[model samples]
Target: MRVVSLVPSLTEAVAVTLPGVLVGATEWCTHPAGLDVARIGGTKNPDVPAIVALRPDLVLANEEENRAPDLAALRAAGIEVLVTEVRELPQAIRELDRALRACGASARPRWLDEAETAWLRLPPLQGRLRAVVPIWRRPWMVLGRATFAGDLLARLGVDNVYADHAERYPRVPLDELRGTRPDLVVLPDEPYRFTPDDGPEAFEAPAVLVSGRHLTWYGPSLGEAAGVLATALGR
Candidate 1:
């Protein structure tokens, strides 16, 4: 079955589970290193004509990672688009299983089981460390209510300071971030590439550099995300 995955995590899951099944993917899909596939474009602005030309049997996307218009266009072109919604960890696991099964997997992937088990094994939270997780700079937006990253961090015993915000991703003044005085600032390496030299200076709290793929991705990365993030959080 020819498939095109628009989400990086989805790309990794499908490629690792059913090698040679993906005919196209976004240029941003950088996991399962040495992946060689047709680059459609980025998640937000994928080239529709280029994707349609590949003629994939199924196009995999996420409700938040992919745009509605792009999915609509693919549907209008008569392509089957399976858009998954993953606001939290449970939803992510269920969607991953459903998406893979729809892609023709006879049973659940072992990595899926491993990923779930890893999280289940986490020791109870000793201290709920409050943190500010910035995803972007300049305008400065952060993880807010009902985000997968926030939920994942909660599992790791970290709470997002802005988790109660009305917006999923809220733009806050840099000064406000510092003024809120969170326990620490968690920085990820993607969506903005927050590095030690780049993101830490803006805040007064201690900074913890984390892998964006591990913090945000929900595929095979899930199996290791807990351990990786736990080490980063020093919990």
Candidate 2:
């Protein structure tokens, strides 16, 4: 099946599991390094006309990474769009299977099955660690409520201090984050690159710099994400 993926995670999964299926992808779909395909545009503002011109049989997207209007535009052009929602690991695993099947993967990929096993094999947390996860630093936005990243951390025994906030990704005052007195400050290298020098200095707690792809992406990386993230959170 000819597919155009707007989500990076799905792009990597499709590219790895069913090669030669992707005809187009968003510029932000950067995993499986050296991936070569027609770049539609960014996730939030994809080039609708360019995508329609590709005439892909299926267009894959994430409800959060893509804009509703753009998906609507693609559907209006008679293109089929399958939007996936992944709020947590279980949902992400299910959605990945559903998406790949829609792309004509006759059987589930080994990597997908391994990813599920990897997460399931993770040892339960002896004690949870409280943390403040900052996604963006300009206005200081953090992971709040039912976020995939936050859920991943929780599975690894790190609890988000702001998980009860009204907004999923809320912009809060920097001072307020510091005031939370979390056990650790978890930082990822995307949406905002939080370095040891930049992010950790703002808070008194120790900092854990992690791979955003492993922490956030829900595809092939999921197999190794638990180990990588758990190790980082341990340090």
Candidate 3:
């Protein structure tokens, strides 16, 4: 079964699980290091014509990563599209299972099992830290309510300062974020590539740089996320 994936994490999941089944993927789907699939453009603005030309049996997309119009266009073109909504670790795992089965996977991949074990085996947090996690820098967008990243952090005993905000990814004034007086500021290396020298200086609280993939990507990297995030939070 030929598949074209628009979501980066889902792309990695499919590619790593079923090798050559992935015939196309978005330019942002950068995993498996040396993936040689046809590039269909970025997640938000995928080339619909190019994707349709691939003649894939299934097109995978995420509720957040992809634009609705693009998915609609694909469906209008008569292409079968599978849209996955993964708001948390558990949802991601379940969605991965569903997607793989839909794509004709005979058995669950070991990495999927390993990811589940990794998250489940995480030790209960001894203490909780209130944190403000910034995803973008220019306008200062932060992780807000119902976000996967926020849920992941919560599971690790880090509570998001704006977890109750109405917006999932809200753009807030820097002053407002600082006013929250969070105990820690966690920075990821994507969407804005926040570094130790870059992100830490702006906050009064100590900041720790973390792998964006581990923090956000819901695929094989999840197997290492618990340990990696724990080490970063510990430091």
Pick the lDDT winner: 1
Candidate 1: where is the Cα deviation over 4 Å?
A: none
lDDT tens per residue, model 1, 1-235: 9999999999999999999999999999997898989999999999999999999999999999899999999999999999999989999999999999988899999999999999999977777889999999999999999999999999888999999999999999999999989999999998999997999999999999999999999999999999999989998
The models' CA-based lDDT, in order, is: 0.94, 0.93, 0.93
Q: lDDT, candidate 1, residue 161?
A: 97
Looking at candidate 3, the ten consecutive residues that score lowest on lDDT are 118-127
> Candidates' TM-scores?
0.98, 0.98, 0.98
Question: Against the hidden true structure, what lDDT does model 3 obtain?
Answer: 0.93
The per-residue C-alpha lDDT of model 3 at residue 213 equals 97
Residue-pair clashes per candidate, as listed? 0, 0, 0
**RMSD value for candidate 3:** 0.9
Which 10 consecutive residues of model 2 have the lowest summed lDDT? Answer: 191-200
Mark the regions of model 2 whose C-alpha exceeds 4 Å error after superposition.
none
Per-residue alpha-carbon lDDT of model 3 for 1-235, expressed as tens digits? 9999999998899988998999999888899899999999999999999999999999999899989999999999999999999899889999999999888899889999998998898886798999999999889999999989989999999999999999999999999999999999999999899987888899999898999999999988899899999899982
Residue 234, candidate 1: how far off, in angstroms?
A: 0.8
> lDDT (0-100) at residue 217 of candidate 3?
95
lDDT of 2 by residue, 52-166 (tens): 9999999999999999999999999999999999999999999999999999999889999999999899986778899999999888999999999999998898999999999
Name the candidate, 1 or 2, with the larger lDDT value. Answer: 1
List runs of model 3 lying over 4 Å from the truth.
Answer: none
